[model samples]
Target: MVTPGSPRGIDVKIGIVDYEAGNLKSVETALRYLHADYFISSDPSVLKKGDKIIFPGVGEARSAMRILSERGLDQFIKDFFKSGKPLLGICLGCQIVLKSSEENSTYCLGLVPGVSREFSVEMGLKIPHMGWNQVSIKGSHYIFRDIPDNGSFYFVHSFYPELDKSSQVIGSTEYGIEFSSAFSVDNLVALQFHPEKSGPFGLKILDNFIKGAD
Candidate 1:
């Protein structure tokens, strides 16, 4: 949880993983607006040094996995999570945190059980759940401290993670079916939506994360 304190001297070194498949610039700009001390790196060493890490993606799951494997980041991410430092995965980045993905049958970081699968065409809903959507909080989480219930956030994805109910699911949203939109277990935090583009509510969420890093 975040405690009230001076925003300056926070000294929080946040690392945003550049796996070569995401909108990292927008995320970095949002953090900069919040005065967060951060850097963008694909190197495992720099990532390991971060007090917190943000994994953001905006492309295919298989391609993203290929990039991570090609750069040997798969193992680095796993080891980093084991270190108990806070990690926030966004968009397809959140899907890779799971055990595997059905998109290409590729193994993932396995930080969480279950696999990511594409939304069923039979559901008759849009393939990609794009545009703004409201995410209902399922439970109290440090990330949503100052955010309101049923807050709208921007999202763009065709696939969604089917996490086990036993896992800590902190937020949910409905497209064709009710599915997890965000979740956190210990230091691993993930969001299927793009909070960086979600306006003031999104900024508050980032602020809470930075404050908690202290």
Candidate 2:
């Protein structure tokens, strides 16, 4: 376990899964700022050893799933979640963790019971929905420990998760329509926003995950 307030998470190792989908530098920078001990890798063998995992990405769904499958990370991630360890997902990572995506009709990890759907063009909003948006907290979770209700977080995506009624929707955002912005299931927590780039509150979210998540 990582001691709280330690400069380098004294005993914790966080693995940032790199499946050739997203830019990892921002996530790395945030972890470094939190004084976390982490490594970025695509190897399942290496990632499996981490005390916690961060799965973040930005890209088209089908292509991203293809890369994960090609590198055998698809199954590895599923197994990791089944191990009941702390796992965090962001953006595309959050989308692909669902059952499938409307983006090119891609099949996803199914860790969460949902499907990713593209925002309707008729919504009259921007395509990517890029920028800081407010996330209304819907329930309690370690990741939201220090975050205020309706705190704004950075988001960049064209698709959003349409979770099952049985799924826990912990955060919701409105962009012409109300959509799930965050969800938690057992040891897994995912967000549609980018906490790393959302400034102080965002950092707080990451901090909570690193130091407070069980």
Candidate 3:
């Protein structure tokens, strides 16, 4: 039997928040391949067993915020972050974790002091900024640990985080302009790229996350 308040003797239970987001299946698939035990749930009680949380999204900002509010998950996430558990937010999930988003002027979780803005169409770059791009590791982050200093990850979004505190930006990539590609602030970490679709390099990142599930 496992000791209470110590490391639980079970497969790492990862909670994938089902908040009407996108690319959740790929997240699950990556975790499964890492031999992690996880479940997708909107219920806070069900998520109580999870050692870590993954909030991935592929949807409009306003609608996504509305859905999270309707499900009472907006506050849930805020409170959960206080517990100091490892929380990973991807793409739209990354946006909503900030104070506000330019996308429809949506207010988000305020977990990070930042704003999400869209890439200017006049910049002669792709609108969505989709496909693999090199991510320059600016500093040490738990998720990026043990990965190549220079690596590429899959990205598929137009909006990117503009952090109020530049120190939180641990990873960055160039598109039309250099934007905050990833952030790590204590227990909360968010990435604009899709590590699930990033192949071996991506998998290695996920593997590091799994190992850090303690």
> Best by TM-score, which number?
2
Q: What is the lDDT of residue 152 in candidate 1?
A: 95
lDDT of each: 0.84, 0.88, 0.85
Which clashing pairs does model 2 show?
Answer: none
Candidate 1 lDDT by residue in tens digits, 1-214: 2223336445789999998865798889889888788998999877888898889899987788889888878888888888988888988888889988888777888899877888999989887889999999977888898788998999998888889754588899999998888988789888999988888887778777876733
Better of 1 and 2 by lDDT: 2
lDDT of candidate 2 at residue 200, scale 0 to 100:
87
Rank the models by TM-score, top first.
Answer: 2, 1, 3
Candidate 2 lDDT, 167-198, residue by residue in tens: 48999999989999999888889999998899
Q: When superposed on Cα atoms, how far off is each prediction in RMSD?
A: 2.9, 2.9, 4.9
Better of 2 and 3 by lDDT: 2
The digit string of per-residue lDDT tens for model 3 on 70-171 reads 888888788779989888898898889999999999998999998999999899887899998999998777688767776889999989999999999989
What candidate 3 gets wrong by more than 4 Å, as runs, is: 1-11
